[model samples]
Target: MADHLRDRFTAFFQKNVANPVMRRNPLQTLLETTGRKSGQPRRTPLGGSRVGNEFWFVSEFGDQSQYVKNIQANPRVRVRLRGRWHSGVAHLVPDDDPRRRLQSLPSFNSFGVRTFGTNLLTIRVDLDN
Candidate 1:
């Protein structure tokens, strides 16, 4: 089916291409959450914005995403923005309207989310100074 192909393609591209490129890009924003099982730090490239002391981003796979599951088990996290890392506590806002939130984010990123994202979930991270 279409979904199956999309899933396979997404997995391949993310592992072989997107992740590697994002890891090296200084401008790319990243989210770091603790691994739920391994208790190791896990980082993933993301597109988001910081408002005051909070950082916001939408997950394409919602609760099904590994990072979201990690956030659920441990709210503590860190975010790298503009090459500076900041510690934060993540909060999953299931009640927030992700589509509406996307409209307020950067255009290029938002377009990708709106186009490719299937199960959108909004997350807000409260930074610790």
Candidate 2:
């Protein structure tokens, strides 16, 4: 019941406010995953770290996130970093400790994830050359 309400609230907030703001922010990172139902490209703003060829991020809603579900349907994804897009393959790392992973990411994003994230899920995206 509580989870349901949280989901509803989050959906409303993201759709009505957060997403629009993030989309316009030059510094914000965006994740592109195929839509599960529509099979169309879906872009979602996010925050994470890039190490070597891998991009890592922790989803606040975990599998409950629409993008995460899209990843489940198709692992292929794209990430926009520093104003450019990179193709990648997303890997869900349930065994990886999300709280620990957050420490290695950007501090501002990490703070929000730590504070608001409910079902944290670690995702690693292996970028293409």
Cα lDDT listed for each candidate: 0.89, 0.92
Supply candidate 2's per-residue lDDT for 60: 90
Q: What tens-digit string does per-residue lDDT give for candidate 2 at 12-129?
A: 8987899988999876799999999999999898899999999999999899899999999999999999988999999999999999999999999899778767899999999994
Question: Which residue segments of model 1 deviate by more than 4 Å?
Answer: none
Count clashing residue pairs in model 2.
Answer: 0
Q: What shift in Å separates residue 62 of candidate 1 from its native position after superposition?
A: 0.4
Q: Which candidate is the best by lDDT?
A: 2
Error of model 1, residue 81, in angstroms: 0.4
In terms of TM-score, the best-performing candidate is: 1
- The local lDDT score (0 to 100) that residue 27 gets in candidate 2 is 63
User: Per-residue lDDT of 1-129 in model 1, one digit per residue for the tens?
Assistant: 786677667767876899788979887899989999999998898898899999999997789788999999999999999999999999999999999999889888888778777789999999996
